[model samples]
Target: MKKRKIFFVTGARSEYDIMHPVLEQLQDSGEIDLQLVVTGAHLSETFGKTVRNIERDGFKIADRIYNLLSTEDKVGRIAGLGSQVTALAHTFNREKPDIIVVVGDREEAISVSLTAAYLSIPVAHLAGGDIANDGNIDNSVRYAATKFAHIHFTFLEQHAQVLKMLGEDEYRIFNTGNPALDKFIHCPRMEKKAVQPLIEFNIQDEPYIVLIQHPIITEVENAGDQIKETLEAVIASGLKCFVNYPNSDAGNFAIIENINAYATKYPDVFHLFKNLDRVNYINLLRYASCLIGNSSSGILEAPSIGLPVVNIGSRQRDRYSAGNVIYTGYDREEITAAIKKSVFDEKYRAEVKAIRNPYGNGDSASRISDVLKTIALDDKLIYKNITYKVF
Candidate 1:
């Protein structure tokens, strides 16, 4: 039997990590030939050579497109997208796959979706149908990708409904849950002894919070100030803080600068890491007092582990959140209160600990892989019709 070639495009470390399980599933199954394309932040040294992380996981990379500009500004992001489209055009022309699978709301995913749409390739999008109402360009890019996608794997049923409302066919949308949480479904949490060697700083007996803030490109100018507020709030909470670097987004330099400045002042209480292995990262989240960030992980992954999250600012604004998340403004006082509430408030902690995660069961990769294994690869899928619904 001829194997259907399924291509996957991974741009940043976060997307690669989230989508890695699906790739593993497709590769493990004998039905499809897996083609992995690495690009964007994966190639950037500033992003910690995260492609090595992918390589370390033993997936063979089919192509590497170096499109990310050294500068992580707005113009550079656009240029990177254009470069990706051109490079992927060459790749698609050379190795036309049955389908292209992309995840999340990054520029690289948008570029791949657009290129596949133009190339008449079936595009499967994961984690669509959710919106971040903030002024982030990811909102528009995500919607555009959804419109171009032939198959949508949304994390929640509400997201699938939103995709249908956006004119996507009901039959083509699957509420498979967040693929990021799949690995944690039955995996045992890494004990402190196992995770201790992974980080440079000591995990003291005192409670600590995990902070993973990123810059919203629309609010780029205030990125530094926002990080400062979070730092102050974390310090005010009197807990040790584990600061993870921001994504390789346009305004990340400001956040990095603020983090570096804070590290110097509070070396004892503030621990910094460039990046953590997947196991170590999840272990940190599993044992953290609370997660404080604008990262989607706060909204999507924290609830699965029953971790409390204090989400600050508008980067993740208006995104679907679980009961475990506390939304607060960027002001230091508001952020401080939320952290204190998430950490020390026993009633709130009990409520968070008892809530169910709206994101589906952690088997999204298998659900997506099963669909891809037998999905019809024909001209019909290439030419999509708007399933217009009367609202």
Candidate 2:
């Protein structure tokens, strides 16, 4: 019997981490020939050249697509998408994999799904049907991927129901939960003493905050001002902040500029990083007093460890969150008060600790792996139909 060829596309550190567990499962299945197509920020030095992280994890890269543009604005993002579509179409044509797997709503997801649809290859989309009406282009991109995708693996039952409403066939949709949590649950926790050397901060001696705010595409011009508000709030709270750089999105240059200025101005309390490995990042979340930012980690992964999150602004506005998040706008005072409540309120902390993560049971990788191995590859899977039903 010939092994099934499964090709996975990863564009950013966050997307790669989310898909790592499933990638591991597929590689270990013995029934799969896994191909990894690395692209976007993974190949860019400005984003830490995270392709090395994948290589360090010991996965053989099938190909690398260097499609990230030097410009950091809306025009650059669209141009990068066009580059990805062109490059990925040629790659998929040459490789001819049994299926193409993509995660989340980034440009990579749409690029791969769109290319695979044109090539008559099945595309499996993870984290589809999850709503984040954050006024960013992400929501539209995610929903568009859903229409092109042949199989849907969502993070929640609610998200699966969303696929149903979107006219996706129920049999093709699986509520496999978030694969990122699988890694979070299984990765060995790093002690504060060990974490100190990695972060260069004495987390054991004082409470610290993990900050990861990304720029919203719709509000590109104000990205610098928006991050300044977050910086002011975090600084005013007087907590040592371990800040992460934003993703490779439009307006990220402004956000990075503000973050750099703040870090230089307050060297003692502000620390900035391009990226951190998954284990170190998870452990940082484990020991932080609170997480302050608009990154989806605040919405998806933070709750599992009972970390209090002060989610500032609309990047994650309508996303479903566990009981651990406190939503606030871009106002400095409002963000400061939320940070205070998250970090200092013992009662709120206790309540947050007691709330279970609604995402999944950390077995999503196994479930997704099983489907990929067993699902039949035929015309039925390639040709999709809208499953409209009377409600």
Candidate 3:
């Protein structure tokens, strides 16, 4: 039998990390030809040019789309999305892959799905049906991608049901859990001493926090203030912090500015990083006293490690959590209280450690790979029908 060519589009470090396990499984399969298209923040120097990490992982790059705009605002973001669509259309026309796979609700996922739909190509969208009605603009983008996607690989059964309500055919949707959890589950925990050198922090003896807050698109003007509140709270907690850079969204520049300012002002208490490979990041979470941020990592991966999360603002408001996350607003006092509860409250900490992660069982990659290998590539898969009943 001829091998099926599968194209996977990854735009940022976080998205790539979530999709890595699935990519590995597909690449190792004898019946599949995996093509990875690196684009968005992966190709931008300002975002640490994470494409190097992909190369370091030893996956052969099929193409690179330098579509990210230097301007960090809403207008620039839209322009970049348009550029991605144009670039991907040309690449897809040249490659003509049997299937194109994308993950999450970022611009990359929607751009690929939209372009593929226009070209009559089947698109497999992972994490399509998840909801995070946190005024981040991604919630709407996620649903838009679902409409264009031919196959849905959701992380939860509830998410799959969201696709069904969105008119997606049931046969095309698969509850493969989250492939991100596969990496977290199998990753061995490193001792604090071992992790300290990697993150450049002395965390062996003292408790610390992992902070990863991002800018909310709907509240772009308040981006700087929002992060300031979180930083102040984390600082007040008196725990050393390892702060990761926010994603390349519209309001990210403001968040980055605040992060840099905080890092400079309190160099001893706060450490800033552009990026960390998945291994270091997972281990960082494993040993952290608490995680403070609105990044999806807090909602999805942190719980699996039994890490308490103080999810600030609305970026992940409606997303399902495993009782390990504490949601708070943008007020510094409220944020500080949440952090206190997450770290110093012994009862809360114990309960969090005992909670089982509902995300996945670490086999999502294999399941997704199996479906990709066997799902028939034909008109039935390409032409989608609404599964909704009008009566």
lDDT of 2 by residue, 1-391 (tens): 8889999999999999999999999887777899899999999988899999999987878899988998865888889899889999999999899999999999998999999999999999999998977778999999999999999999999999999999998888999899999999788987789989998876788899999998888988888899999999988898899999899898889888888998899999899889899999998889999999888998898888889999988888889989799999999999999999999999999999887888977999999999998998989888888888667
Candidate 1, superposed: residue stretches over 4 Å from native? 389-391
C-alpha lDDT (0 to 100) for residue 383 of candidate 2 = 88
lDDT of each: 0.85, 0.91, 0.89
Model 3's lDDT to the true fold? 0.89
Query: How many clashes (backbone atoms < 3 Å, residues ≥3 apart in a chain or on different chains) does model 2 have?
Result: 0
Name the 10 consecutive residues with the lowest summed lDDT in model 2: 199-208
Per-residue lDDT tens digits for candidate 3, residues 1-391, read 6689999999999889889998889877756788899999998877888999999987878899988887766898899999889999999999999999998989988899999999999999999888776767788889999999999999999999888888988999999998999999999778778888888878878888989988877888888888888889888888899999988887888888888998899999999889888889999888889998888888888888789999888888889989998889899899889988888999999999998887798999999999998999889999877877889
**Which has the higher lDDT value, candidate number 1 or candidate number 3?**
3
lDDT of 1 by residue, 1-391 (tens): 8788888899887888788878888778867788789998788777788889988887878899998887856898888789889999999889998899999899876888999999999999998888788888888888999999898889888889999888887878888988778876555677786776787667746678999998888887888888999999888888888998888777799889889889999997788887787878888888788999887888888888788998888878778778788888989999999999888999998888887778757788899899988877777777778888567
Off by over 4 Å in 3: none
Residue pairs whose backbone atoms clash in candidate 1: none
> Which candidate number would show the highest lDDT if scored against the true structure?
2
What TM-score does each of the candidates earn?
0.97, 0.98, 0.98
